[model samples]
Target: MTKKTQTPAVQKGNTDPNTLQLHKDPAQTDAAQIAAMALGSVAANAMTARSFAKGTFGTLDVTECVMTLKQRVDTTHGGDLKHAETTLTAQAATLDAIFNEMARRAALNMGEYLDATERYMRLALKAQGQCRATLETLAAIKNPPIVFARQANIAHGPQQINNEAISGTTTTRARKTRTRQNELLEEPQHGSTQLDDRTTPASARGHTAVEAVEPIHRTTKRRRESSGGA
Candidate 1:
């Protein structure tokens, strides 16, 4: 058994092109190889760097999903990608310092970008609301009567639900009950007289002195009537 191995084209010393059936114009091998390399490179880098940049511009895609090196344009003469990349790499020290500081503070690579974007959005919304409120207030101040939009009476819970009418009725009934109870406790006084028994005797108080003297005249009249009848 023999070990198999790959062999290069006709050796440099071999000289029989027709008899050995070796290839003519040996430069074809080099040209074919160069062509294969060129086509492979082109196929590898079909998406230009500019296209990748546009795809990723202002978008918050994850780091793992970012553009790849092969996505950059393939060229013997370096283009904008070379310059832009060189410039960016030149400042990589500063970027690395920023990244280190952020990491020390426990920041994720994509989290910083996303956090800044979200913060900006929130601030923008807050500023918009403030501007709107300011405009409304200024408009109100300019008018003579200064009519302002009424704020909605947002009831937080059951505190104000049917509370006003019910509370008023309960209060009124309580007051009326208190008034009736007070009137019952407060009685009116009738007319009153003041008297003293200081001058009256204990025994003769039953008959007055004028009533005792009235019997004398009645007895004389009765005696004259009896004589006339005899």
Candidate 2:
């Protein structure tokens, strides 16, 4: 006869039960987090691609799906600019056709002198304007306008100096040291000085100097006397 072994059992309300410990690897934990993030990103992109493909192509055809994705990629890569050029060109041609048809109907209606003749002429003019606008838009797209930016300084303090070349030369310009107050107070080297001094006579300041003039009649009488005596 064999006897069975009996195991001990703990009470239901026991606070100290059993516990197991495990060590974690830092490198493995980091790698696992990175993998999870990558998968989540892939799932998000798949959802986006599916939505775009469904909306654009209506059916998930492989060619159309790829084309739709390619369009998005092209837009990101600035391919829309080239697309715009061709689209505008086509629009301009369409507008020209519309203008011609409208003008022909207007001419025929004018000869008939019908009640809608004025309306036809009006529509023709409108189409002509629209065609002109389309052509102008195409021209603008082909040749963009050049923008000129100039820096200007406005203040009451000392004059501002610019380091940039005025025309195209790299030569530095002479500093401007003269102002309105300086001109009025300082004596000039070339022209007449505005300020009068005791050392320099007013006549020495050139034709611009201020001085009293003799009376015209007295000078004429003196000239006559000198002529008579001669």
Candidate 3:
């Protein structure tokens, strides 16, 4: 038979436990809120870095430097200078590609940030709207409800009604004015029409399509008559 082992019971502590408990103090919470606000403020005011790699040795105007080097390379004929130029050109192109890649990555990061911010803003707006609706619903249950009076005085007031009526009238008047303007534009004054007729070529202004073709028909008839006579 296998020997069985029994586990011993843990003894209770004889000393009293410390009364102190971990809790967030109001001051600490306030400090954290302030810190968060400061961070947010800093972020809001911060400018985008022009160079992705700051303090790295070399000029930021890589393209301009490359162009200047190319100009020098064009003038250079010595083997040593040509070799140096070729090396430099290659290095400059590589640097340009590096900066380009950095800029591309930065743009992608900015776009992602914008998308996140936009989504957060939309969610915030929706939440705010829901909260407002809830508040309004609660306010509506009160004796002589404040929202109803405010809505009646401001939102659905006589002034608003009058404004709507005036807007409609103005819109109708505008439409009529536009129609009159269009008619005036399309049908010029009698004197202006006469002036236009005087300035325009007779063939272009006066002749109808069929009337314009009459000259061609007359020429064809004359040719036929001559041919018959001959």
Task: Rank the candidate models, highest TM-score first.
Answer: 2, 1, 3
Q: Which candidate model has the greater TM-score, 2 or 3? A: 2
Runs in model 3 with CA error above 4 Å?
Answer: 1-112, 144-230
Error of 1 at 99 (Å): 1.3
Write down the lDDT of every candidate, Cα atoms only.
0.46, 0.60, 0.47
TM-score of each: 0.17, 0.39, 0.16
Off-target runs (Cα >4 Å) in candidate 1 are 1-38, 46-51, 57-88, 91-94, 97-101, 107-230
lDDT per residue as tens, model 1, 1-230: 99889786875553432121223456578667556644664433432333465566633222212233334443314544454445444454444454445444443324667766555555545544554555454445444373444333548875443434236678889999987866664434211121224644233234355555555554444444454554
Error of model 2, residue 85, in angstroms: 1.5
- Kindly list the per-residue Cα lDDT of model 2 for residues 36-145, writing each as its tens digit: 53465443454466667677655443333444545755684773566666767888788778777877777887767776677777777787787788778878878889
Residues 1-230, candidate 3: write the lDDT tens digits. 99889899888543322221123467677667656634642222221121333356333343333344446555653433545545545655554555455445445556568765555555545544554554454344333343322222356445552234235678989999988876675454422433244575333344355543344333334444454554
Error of 2 at 93 (Å): 1.1
Task: Give per-residue lDDT, candidate 1, residue 57.
Answer: 68
Could you tell me the lDDT of residue 194 within candidate 2?
Answer: 54
Minimum summed lDDT over a 10-residue window in model 1 is located at 187-196
Q: Which stretches of candidate 2 lie over 4 Å from their true place?
A: 1-80, 150-230
